[model samples]
Target: MIGEREVLTRAQLMAGGLSRRGLVRALNEGVIVRARRDQYVSAAAPSAVVQAVRIGGRVTCLSLLQLLGVFVFANDVVHVHIPRGASRLRSPESVAKPLGARGRRRARLHWWPLSATPPAHSACTGIVDALAHAVRCQPPRQAIATLDSALNKGLIGFADVEDLFALLPRKYRVLRSLIDGRAQAGTETLMRLMVRGLGHEAVPQVHFARFGFVDLVVDGWLVVECDSRAFHSDWAQQVKDRARDLELAKLGYVTLRFTAAQILHQPDDVLAALRGMLGAGRRKPPPRN
Candidate 1:
């Protein structure tokens, strides 16, 4: 049963036939880890991750996003949600901000708690609660990217998204429309929002002429590609990308590629290029209602 959270209390270890001598041996060999205050977790598990739950807080927000392989910018803070009025959290080093508010910059503490966190899942916020915290606290771009990644991974479904919005504060509900599974990366969502914010419709991961999906298509003709340096650093991928662009060009789609840095850091240049192309095509952006 190593799959079920992989943590154990000392009592659990004793009940499972681990003798005191065996416990001592495992601890000495570094095969078992002390998750603090009478709790024991596998050596492979991060101490803080186990301690977060052991200290009676559920991990949430950017911390959970990083754990779930979603697109979050940083994890300087260990985000943990404690039920209102509980003060069991104890890590001083990472909890950089002065304690009080929930959305503090580092080692965030979400004070809201909805239901009993089942003992089986106590170490982390339940998926829904974590998503709610993410939506309520993050900027729209960050929120949508995490949502899109979760949707793409089938970690959450359409109904779940609706439920997440219903659980969020009124201010965050407006971002529901921007949550799209077709966005493959945070950069894609950021670029799409930039284009749409300027009144242009940009569809993400659009497939053309059976040539697999491109990163985005704008105004039904301009293909905008964002190459993340982390994934597209080699000659082979570059060659394949160019080949795809040429194939799309044959089908009347003009492809414009940008690096992830350009998409995130150089938004002005990206917008300028997009506006120039839109003007050249004589395409008027559709009116938004």
Candidate 2:
């Protein structure tokens, strides 16, 4: 086995039952490729992982989170984790050449010391370390969303949250209370934060007897739905959403739907609209028939 990320050192491969001859045979047959003198990766390894290893570090931070299927705000470049005090970094294209020699830098390197040693054949930093670095890499609100996403996806548990906080500076501890694993999407997380910033209590994923769970409920009557294109682009989904809104309206709940773009890129405008709506007055739901 090459490893979960499909990368392993020659020694690791040997220990996993690949004899020296088998290793050579694998290399010759293109089953594996040498990323470095002793570092070997399966031919099917993720390019980002291979690239990070070639660049003399492990994939980490937002880049690593993205690879792990976590909700990362952005991943424009590879984020490599090089040990503190490391030197003589090599280019990802050709390890012989020094880093930055080929052309523009291809990766964002983090020189922070790792809190714990990664697995022997890991092509990426541990999830906790990646998350610790990720929170610092993103803005405060985005950081909280990232944490919420990780928790919601079951990638990390509540106990791991404390470990992640321990790795961060003291000031970041304040964000601990803001994380809510019930948020199913990054946009929902952002929207919840916006509502809270306006002094409104926002409950996420509230289920009703007749209807399924809504994204958020603010002040008990205002329903906030974060519609990402991935789930809402189809006409059928749109029809269902409209029907749900109509049903909620009958129950005296006002639904405000926001697209992912509006929630992420136009926060001020979205917040302003929400502020206006919340200021109007709360709509009390009618009594049961």
Candidate 3:
């Protein structure tokens, strides 16, 4: 059986009884790609795009977001960093399995000269490159999540943002303004930015005595819960969420639950509902429970 990873060296493939001709044929058929002189990565390895990283490119943008365990909203394109002058995107029809939606291109190749050259065989992009690409390539809401996650990990600072932004084109420099390092999840980053846009103070990872740790607290009492399928799809997780909701209600905190799908796809509806709730809540504060 194929392992979770699809990155293979020529020798490894040969050891598995594949002849050189077979390997070449696979490459010709787009079943794999030569990540380097010796390394080969399968196009249809698993859920994530291993082809780009396997073939000496660093994954970036929404691709890196997914790789880093961040909340990614849209990621149909596999993003990879190829050398600015010499490298070419390798996830093409002749090299690896296609990665895009039906009739769309498979991957996004970003040309950048890495500060340190990768080895003859490399598997991933540098953290800095991945982060920079995430900010430059993704939209403001999506980029904020990458920045906030970096901050939460203590990997970057507010001062560092301007410097990084300076390295990018002027168009992407606006990303520096939307950063809030206090965000916990990618969805929380998105939800906080959304609520704050409505002129309300939306603080993230707030603690209530009964509910333990809520995702976001808007205007001191309204709790916003962002549900991710990976984190909360199980029965036990659902029960815990229900219990948290029950306890928060006892403390006069009105909770609004939003799925990642709802937040990403039907944002206008979520925003409208939040606006309506905040409008009425501001009229009269609920008494302490």
Candidate 4:
């Protein structure tokens, strides 16, 4: 019955079959609630996930991040990349404008449009979306992580990475390389910087005999563990990590662990301790089988 009900136009309501007086009477009686002119969401309907969907019903970039369960800290207005040549004012209040188009009025809440068409496939959408936000938002590391998750999960193919990189501004050169180098995981990237800051060569993520696969190996001898609080806080996982560390010790691998905060805020201390370890010849190999 509700589906079949016609949306009465202002003129139609004034014409009598759906009278302006009747519409006013319904609203006063709670029979209908005005959502927007020509747009009415039922009062009992669930709130729409407006941020997750781009204008014109496109999927949003950060919403894709949320869908992929990637960690993101931004809670401000959602970022949406409108393709060039899209209807500029799809909604009068829409936050969309041409990205590179000249002499356009830019507005907050709505971002300028990019010149390319957004991919409809999930992975391509994710990569393009992250790249677009990275360009506007200025956080290289978070952008790189978003790109990494999309790539690692096989959402975006390797071939597309360069194309995305080319679209970025030159100021983000180092960050672009870091993303290209596959330092997709924030934990891994931070740990990599910490090791380098400490004057240690960062080893690739490798399989450790007891610790299973570890975060990063420094000088091929010292195992550097980047512990995210969420993972380390689990009692069972913590017990398992302790057991793994003990085994790693017995096998002659020295362990140095840092929390996320230590890597982010007090990285210099991590570097100093790492420098000491490096200077002390911490390169003893594990016992051979």
lDDT of each: 0.73, 0.86, 0.70, 0.54
Q: Write down the RMSD of candidate 2 (Cα, Å).
A: 2.2
Ten residues in sequence with the least summed lDDT for candidate 2: 280-289
> Could you arrange the candidates by lDDT from highest to lowest?
2, 1, 3, 4
Give lDDT for model 2. 0.86
Q: Which stretches in model 4 have alpha-carbon errors above 4 Å?
A: 1-49, 52-63, 73-76, 82-112, 119-126, 180-184, 209-211, 264-276, 279-289
Residue 57 lDDT (model 3)? 61
Clashes of each: 1, 0, 2, 4
User: Any residue pairs clashing in model 1, and if so which?
Assistant: 77-107
lDDT (Cα, tens digit) per residue for candidate 4, span 1-289: 0221122334544554656677777668755544334432223321222322223233345644555555453433434444446453333233352222221222113244543644332212445645555445636555665666566666667667766666666666566555533443566675675566566678646675444587777777788888878888799988988887788778777878888777667767877777787788766566522
Per-candidate TM equals 0.86, 0.92, 0.73, 0.62
Write one digit per residue (lDDT tens) for candidate 2, span 1-289.
5754756777777778889999888889988888876888878888788788888789999998898788877777788899877777778777677788341367888888888888766788998899999999999999999999999999999999999899889999999999999999989999999999999999999987876899999988899999999999999999999999999888888899999999888999999999999999866645422
In candidate 2, position 251 carries an lDDT of 86
Q: lDDT score of model 3? A: 0.70
Best candidate according to lDDT: 2
Q: Where in model 3 is the C-alpha error above 4 Å?
A: 1-38, 41-50, 53-57, 87-91, 96-104, 153-163, 234-236, 281-289
lDDT, candidate 1, 84-105, per-residue tens: 7876455433333234444234
For candidate 1, give the lDDT of residue 22: 90
TM-score winner among the candidates? 2
